[model samples]
Target: MAVNYPNGKKFLAESHMPKTTKKKDLIYSNRGMTLEEEINSSNEHYLSSGRAVIHKKPTPIQVVKVDYPKRSAAVIREAYYRQSSTTDYNGVYKGHYLDFEAKETKNKTSIPLSNFHEHQILHMKRCILQHGITFVLIRFSFFNRVFLLNSSYLIDFWEDTMNNGRKSIPLAFIEEKGIDVAYGFNPRLDYLDAVDKLLEHTNK
Candidate 1:
């Protein structure tokens, strides 16, 4: 007699069966978190604890069309990037304005300058000049490392790029000037540590 599966599929006696995921495996499989997920979670923790108020900026999109499937709901059918964003996040931390762009790179030796935009570089400079806490959070995904790269250092590199020079910032260069952001359970990026360090440097 042939065995028939519940889905109306017949199987031979020597047929290979599909592997089933165990309940334990399921729990562990769903445990890992993405960089964005971790960052957002940390932000929520900070907001609730009254440590700081930081939020990811919403990307403006030009919706060309929308489908009204129901009276109470509408689904965006077409959209386009409105314009370039200056930064990924902005907020007031410890009574000081903070602005930064978060980016991820896979390069092991250097972070390509192309990863950053001209407008963002300009915005960071303006923010710094205006006494805002401006920096970039760079996540070297391949190396599983994160760094708080100061706007000053980034600006210097940006200037060089405009001239005749390397188009990327070497990891060694970043290590020398940038502060390494330690990962933790809460405040995943824990960039405030670097910010505090920057504050000390500026004050001194």
Candidate 2:
């Protein structure tokens, strides 16, 4: 389904940019796997191990033009996002619904709220209201820090912004409220550990 911002801005699912390209130069290099790629690999590990069933949602695209040079070969010349995506990833984990968005920022001190759109936040709010486990996996590539922040805190900051507050969340605030996820060899990003903590809190 197509989601839109309050101002009528349609969400574009296929929009994302990697924080860094060169690995050898940066101290916290992702080793060529962008945040999205690492998460995909982690999800694969989870699925294969029967740990979870999370999957990244495919961005729906509307093909504008196509060329057929040969009968067996077809090329997409032009296309655009068909609908605004709800979130980056979602699925079932231990019989509970899991929903989240993954983001990376080069800034070391703070993560801009602009990284999230209105509709995305709304979708998260809805998911939480419906008793789904929702959160955002944010990567601070420069500092080599990855955090799993709950959607409730995200919503609070979002509402604060709408009320004319800060436009970004400071790293200190995130560190205090978010769970630090360590990078690993097998699953890549070990965010599910953070999820366990989140569930623990929720159950309490």
Candidate 3:
């Protein structure tokens, strides 16, 4: 399939091909860094620096078909999008379990509430009830601004949307209720800083 970039550059980006690595180890690269890549790299940095234990949740996928020629590489012919059963990333941080969903949007004013799934929201609510830290890392690509919005604010508006007629969470509301995560060289989103603040509030 051909994809067109925002600048009208058309090209075809092939899907992942099956390959064997020594010991079946996962490889990390910044060559095509998506938001997911940045978060994973940041988590690695944190783990190495004794900062926190956070990791991206691996979603299990079922391969429907594959084609392999003799003495050649294998290609995935078909696959199904797996349902994510948990938050995007989760682990213990400073004695508290932290759960988060990282998302990006091109919209300049607000993030569409539809970007969040019902199951994902319920998972976060459960975490909050269990005294775990729960929040979302929302990146506004247009502005390069990231905010850590707690689950409480999200669910509040989410439920309200059912009858209140708001389809998206306005930027003003996010600015008022969410903690701004400063982007840095290390933890690209630096969401841990906001986590620290959440921890302080809970401890007080």
Candidate that would win on lDDT: 2
Query: Residues 1-204, candidate 3, lDDT per residue (tens digit)?
Result: 773223322322332333232112245432335566667767877998999999888787889998764544455689888999778999988788999998889999999999899999899888888988888888888787888898888888889997877989998889988899886767655778898987777689
Residue 131, candidate 1: C-alpha displacement in angstroms: 1.1
In model 1, the clashing pairs are none
Off by over 4 Å in 3: 1-33, 63-79
Any idea what lDDT model 3 has? 0.78
Per-residue lDDT of 1-204 in model 2, one digit per residue for the tens?
463323322332333323232232155545656888788878888999999999999898999998665433355789998756599899998899999999999998999999999999989989988999999999999987899999899999999999999999999999999999989877888899999999998899
Candidate number with the higher TM-score (2 or 3): 2
Residue 23 lDDT, candidate 3, scale 0-100:
16
Across residues 1-204, which tens digit of lDDT does each residue of candidate 1 receive?
A: 574333423332323443232232245542455555556666877898898999887788899997655332355789998765578788998889999888788899999989888889888988888999998888788878888888888889889888977899999998989999998756666788788998888889
Give lDDT per model, in order. Answer: 0.78, 0.85, 0.78
What TM-score would each prediction reach against the true structure? 0.80, 0.81, 0.76
> What are the clash counts of all predictions, listed in order?
0, 0, 0
Candidate 3 lDDT score at position 66: 83
Q: Give the 10-residue window scoring lowest on summed lDDT in candidate 2.
A: 4-13
Best by the TM-score measure: 2
Candidate 1: residue 182 Cα off by (Å): 0.7
